[model samples]
Target: MDIVFDTQQEAADFYRRMPSSFRQVTGVMLINSRLAVFPQKTADYREFAQLITRYIIEKYEKKWIMFIIEKYYYFTDAEEKVTILNIVAAIFSGEKDDLPHTGTLQDRHETIMASLEGVLKEHNTFSFQSIIRFRLTAYREVLRQYVEIAIDEYKLEQEYQVFVDKLRRIVHAYKPLCEKIEVYDEHPFKLFDEHHRLIRNVQSVRSFYPLLKQWGIEAEPSIILSLIALAPKQVIVYTDRPEHGMMKTLHRVFEERVCFARRTLHLGNGSDYSG
Candidate 1:
């Protein structure tokens, strides 16, 4: 029999109390089921539109049906590869939950308050904002790499090859000629692509979460990709929670390049970042 809970805690407690078989079922669902946000209006529509346009002609679109929850759909496609990628992108794009960060109501309440204040406020007195910004900058680098990878995959796909090739040429040709590409002193040149009026055609895209998720990376790898993209000379890890798997991965990946700094920090900003 299926069970429902009014509160998430109720559900968690139920799972914790379950027999091993039931617990295994829960694990399978979490791992195999593609997560989706409810209240369909919140799902990234731009990504949905793109997914339809990209794969509708592939002739296998009907293999799996979209698991609908109200207006939102999870696992729009049946293919495992495509589905995993979409989930990854959606999670990174903040379209879905961060399973690792899930916690009690107290943690959520604190996060909500912090988010409400907006971490990067111009008037805030938080001394740790600089560190947060630095961390964010590193994350952006990782996103950029994934963005590139997604584009490359599109270009290589047989169905998308012609369109991708044409777009690539246009982008390359427009590169030298477009005087509109704004160059930021501190940020990567790719970030400016959105600001150009000529790219307005592409700018209408509100979400690439589905496309980005296709990479099948967890939270830390996503962050690490962003760090690599930024290519910082030095990095300091500031945190109150030592359980983050990404930090451990960083110790092994970057070795001496990364170090920990004990700081009293609060979660900030739940806003979804653009790719």
Candidate 2:
């Protein structure tokens, strides 16, 4: 029989004990699962949000069912995406377990958080693990800042500690799955486009993660795109002012040059992203 939980700890415990065949952890339902079984240390919100978003969307959203957990919901249908993500703000800033999903601005904030959670995970992983690194050189500082702030806002200190401890116990725990994205003296993941793209976008390989996420990448990889940086392709980021036309001839360039850096940069090369 299908079950619904109004609490994280309760669901976590149940999901942990249940067989994977019939039951699974849905969205933020990790309180008593393996997390409950183990002790926590660094619940960094950056990591926490990312993991929660990924887990929910990857497992439930694709199923085309709106699995709403207490306040958190996972459904990819464009119309419902924003409404569900908003549920996090209630969870984040201390709202009731069953938040009112009205079309209010408060709900809007929560919705944005959920969307950010999904986008941030893709961006961070791409920045840290992509095959191409040099292309990301320019955005490294911004990306790091993002991680710091998101973690802080998410109240993720406990999560971060837990990740560190778990990573230590496992093989290649901190080892990234992408490629050179993290090596750029920074990261590759960024809030790249104001709008999605096609040809010109791919020309500059550095911004692949943001672009991929915008494009709603089909491979749906939790992979490190590259470990070794490759030569970056140039593209212009248009401006909105009068002098700089919407299509100004602004050429975006990489801070450095990389070469045949690493192969199998992403995790989906049929290999494990963690490995």
Query: Which portions of model 2 show Cα errors greater than 4 Å?
Result: 1-43, 65-275
lDDT of 2 by residue, 1-275 (tens): 12234455645644555435222332323432223212122234444444433444344332322223212322346544433334343343455333332222233223324444433434422221121123323222322332233324333534544533332232122232232232211133221121221112332335544643443332222112321112213222222231321111111112122221232233221221221
Once fitted onto the true fold, the runs of candidate 1 whose alpha carbons sit more than 4 angstroms away are 1-221, 265-275
- Decoy 1 TM-score against native: 0.19
C-alpha lDDT of all candidate models, in order: 0.34, 0.31
- Measured by lDDT, the strongest candidate is 1
Query: Against the hidden reference, what TM-scores do the models get?
Result: 0.19, 0.16
Tens-digit lDDT track of model 1 for 190-240: 112323221222222323223324433222224444333333344455554
Cα displacement (Å) at residue 125, model 2: 28
